[model samples]
Target chain A: MVRPRYFFSETFISLRRNFFMGFTAITTVAITLFVVGFFTIIVYDIQGIISSVESEVELAVYLEDEISEELKDYIEKEVLSWEETDSVNYVSKDQALERFREQNEGSDILKEIEGNPLPASFEITLSSPEKIDQVALRFYDKDGNYIEGVNDVIYGKNYVNKLFSITAIVGTIALLIIIVLLLAAIVLIFNTIRLSIYARRKEIEVMKLVGATNWFVRVPFLFEGFFEGFVGSVISIILLYFVGNFLLIRGERVIVDTMRIKELAIVGSSGVVLYVYIGVAVLGGLIGILSSAIALRRYVKI
Target chain B: MNMIEFKQVSKIYEDNTVALKNINLEIKKGEFLFLVGPSGSGKSTFIKLLIKEIEETEGSIFIAGRNICNLKSNRIPQLRRNIGCVFQDFKLLPNKTIFENVAFTLEVIGKPVYEIKIQVPQVLKLVGIFSKINSYPHQLSGGEQQRVSIARAFVNRPPILLADEPTGNLDPGTSEGIMKILSRINLIGTTVLMATHDRNIVNSMRRRVVELEEGEIIRDQKRGVYGD
Candidate 1:
């Protein structure tokens, strides 16, 4: 037998009467959610950068200059058959000389080279960047000696290991910070709701004396909390949409132009922005309702 | 049949202050009674017990022949709906208009809009405050605000009405007007129990009077004056 019209009207009227308090509550929610949204976007962008950088990790396996075409083909197939290997491409000695000349087109280094002295090599990408060392080690025997016709394997093992560990640490810290921020937002909302309840205590007393059920007295306040949260979250989402776009565009430009690392540039897709908006809005509303419920438990005695 | 009964009821506060001790009283349906006492005589406690605001430490209270001592906490609201209450300060919501203040009572009980529209104005007119239906509590005089509060208390037509010093803050003339309204409401067969300190009102009404002293009833008389 709940009446929606009456409850809503009551909520609106109370909100109007306590305009200053309601405004304060809404502002607090908006600012807290805004910070949270910005942090989420930053975390997502960093993760994108880390994953792209991981994908660029590859092993260059140089071959002996006297190797036959059949042996080269066999090495390519063998590397590809490993579960961790994503793809492998064979570069001939002439192709390597051509790439060196192209990289130093105007330099005297190309003129100083008499004939092609580069060795044929296989460039191998891995499905899991962390397993790059294990894949590169496949060309050697247990005695750490290269197998027949293989010259040397190079994959920058030190930097790859350091990058994986750094990414893992960054991921853990980002998760912890987000959890702490969410808890802080909930606490701030709870205090704001408690203040609102204190201001309307007399009205609550009168309602109880007039035969209002505890729920009847509670519904209007709950609606007030939900309305405040909804409005606050919408405001934050709008702010985040504009500010996030500005930041992402500038950040991507700096990473691509100055650092010359195209893989580090974040792609701010519409789908990711939409998901962030929905998550922030829902979180704000739930915080509002939860805080209101807790505040009323102590104040709205029948 | 008795509309309210207190059987050997007692109430002791957490600080060990005895507010009421070994109280026994019965008020029948449609009767008007006055409770008179000095300060700290437990007049407020008597009214509070009827509404179950504070529980009795001993004995039972029956409202409409139901023992309310063992009534569950969730059922307290249902019990309160059967009784209407008024206060000395005219506890009208400062933000609500006279019409809304009256309508609020029915609204909380889930009355339909049409029914509330019909009933709120009718009760406002009953207390002679129909002209100020749209006026907020702060905009009205003390007597006018009291009238609005009365209208709110009577809107639901509960079986019992309790007023705690309803005229304590008004002048003699204004008090008389409030008394007349209470008397008129009583004429319609709604049992009223009012606690007051105004001797003039008690003497003028010539109704059943129960006087309390230090948490115990000192006198109960039919058509009793303020005192001998």
Candidate 2:
């Protein structure tokens, strides 16, 4: 306890002496941490949007028009029993034609048709869009032979594939960008702390000569770094709060309509905001501590 | 009781430059000894070895009966706290006031605030620099800065004091003041090991002198002068 108090006082004095250098360190930490936090928010929301969009795609499995009622019932039961199938609805020929006519209400071509040409189908919803191929495969044999009563299983193959590829690409690029940003933050924090340590090299030498324990000299520096991180994180969190509140008030309509975000969960949820602030502060503190520890390696040798 | 002992101590640099070669020496408690040597005669290495700043390539060192050569790195500071050190450069923290400079030693060793509050002034007064305690090192003359350094060294009242050319930067008049202070501390029963090249101080004091030539102790005399 006494050691902590002494370290705190020493840190205060050192910070005061090297005010500009210390300020640079804190400001750099704040700006970088803010960017990281913002990036995290964007990535999370994008992922949420992608998942929501994927859930809307459904497979339409058309049946033979001349198929027996018992065969249709069997296919329906088989699909429904599959673990990946969320739900399967059987549409009769008449019902299919009715839907087509309603969808094409302005067209008189369907009214002029001699007889109903539409095929009965099973509309299937899946637990996940990624399981569509597996569900489609079950309707056919391994040799591409369509099952006895099934004519076709269609789920917009090209569109679903494109959606998946795009999401994968976006995820990869975002991960790369986040990794680069993290590296930049570490280097900047390290350099800032190195400069601060350089300024006190002489004082450190004197301290060592006087028989100061390595920890005695190092603890104060560690605390100084921690304080810089704490101050930086606090300032950035305050900025984030104001920005979040402003975005919530001003961009609500745009976000809801275009981005399709559910109130921008990070902005709307008070609990989420609190967690983000805490995370940033902890990260800042950790960076400060690690950088200072690395910077002190050379100076503490004697 | 022996204040310090060296058993066949040798220090070889990475480049194989032998600084101290198979040297052996001992000093009893409360003894005042001057180590006289020319430049590059390994005076600095001898002082540094006592504090374990540089480990001996071979052999052992015991300070206050503790084997310092084999002492753990964590224990070096504890050893240093009991061994006061004064350097020729007057290695004071330039930004800190004279009072803070002395108090720093106690602070690092985790002494109580009240103890530091009492001890700092007392040591400064003993060194006769109590009035200039508030001044920074840059604000003082060479001699005054050296005096603050001495005050800081004695602030803990350690059992041993090591001075590596404490007056190296000062003129004869100022050097006399620094020597007198060291002698006074010595008379108070602190073992003093000072290394210097100053002929006048060494000859005038006529104290026990150990002269090193090329990392070898050529002369260890009672009431010895600086040189032949």
Highest DockQ: give the candidate number: 2
**lDDT per residue (tens digit) for residues A1-302 in model 1:** 77999888878877887788788878878877888887777777776777787788889999999998888888888888889989898898999999998999999888899898899899988898889877877899999999988999998799888887887787788778777876776676677677777878888888788878888888888998888888889988988888867877788787667745666535455467778899989988988888889878876766
Off by over 4 Å in 2: A244-267, A270-274
lDDT value, residue A60 of candidate 1: 94
Per-residue lDDT tens digits for candidate 2, residues B60-179, read: 998988888778888888888888999999888887899899999998888898999999999998888899988888989998988898889899999999999998999999999999
Cα displacement (angstroms), candidate 2, residue B170, comes to: 1.6
Candidate 1 second chain TM:
0.98
lDDT per residue (tens digit) for residues A82-197 in model 2: 99888888888999999998999989887687798889999998887887988889989878999899898899888888878987887788778767866666676677667777
Provide the lowest-lDDT 10-residue window in model 2 chain B: B69-78
lDDT of 2 at B118: 98
Model 1 scores what on Cα lDDT? 0.87
TM-score of model number 2, chain B:
0.98
Q: Which lDDT value does model 2 have at A168?
A: 84
- Candidate 1: misplaced stretches above 4 Å? A63-78, A92-120, A136-151, A172-188, A262-270
Real A-B contacts recovered, model 1: 0.69
